[model samples]
Target: MRPRKLILCVEANEQVLSVRKFLLETRGYRVVGCASAAEAIEYLQGALPGSIDLLMSDLQLPQMDGNELVRRAKQLLPGLPALILSNTVTGYDRAAAADAFLPKGACTPAEILDRIRILVARKRGPKKQMPTAEMMPHEMAVAG
Candidate 1:
């Protein structure tokens, strides 16, 4: 059997967090819910490397913005997929390192899961061989 995907969800609103946690858990994902940016950061710092499959956060977070949190999360786990949540999707820049934005109460759980799956699949692309000592400098390649 395939391991259930682990998703780290960061949100300041307790009600929203609870709802998301319940929804995600019921859908077969292992959800790690954090109440604040600080807590999320702390979790990331001590978490086993690559244990988290995706990072999901609210755009309006207390203390640190979602974009900043996503930036820091990616720094620790390169190629980590991210999803930004908001009450209304507006003024979001795709260049901000998030794969997609899910509007609260406006989208279905299946839609949310579908987007997460797409991001995970995109991140887990075709693998490539790492350069060996005998490989020429021109032959060196990196796969995302």
Candidate 2:
């Protein structure tokens, strides 16, 4: 059986955290929810390296911005895959150390799960065959 992946979910809003935690848990990911970068760092400090497989963070954290947070999180767990969530995804610097960007409220649960699965597998284990719908145009052409 495949082991459950761990996702460190960092969001400033308590309500958002609750929803995200529920979604991640329902999808079988062991989630560690944090309200700030400081809180997440504290959790990281208390945990072993590779304990958290992915870092999921909101772009609008009140104090430290998510980009800086991603950099810091990556520093703590080198090669940790990152997913950046935002309403205005273009506002974020996509080059800011994030592996994937999700526009908040724009994806269905299935889509989100698929994305998480791909990211986690890519970061943690051997590459799995991606769903055809997720293939980039160039990738599809190459496959054909």
Q: Best by TM-score, which number?
A: 2
Model 2 lDDT tens row, 109-132:
677767777787677554453354
Give lDDT: candidate 1, residue 29: 74
| TM-score of candidate 2 versus the correct structure, residues matched by position | 0.80
Worst 10 residues of 2 by lDDT: 128-137
Which residue pairs does candidate 1 place in steric collision? none
Runs in model 1 with CA error above 4 Å?
Answer: 127-144
Provide the overall lDDT of each model, using Cα atoms, as 2-decimal numbers: 0.77, 0.78
- Candidate 2: Cα lDDT at 29: 77
Error of 1 at 39 (Å): 0.7
Q: Report the CA-based lDDT of candidate 2 relative to the real structure.
A: 0.78
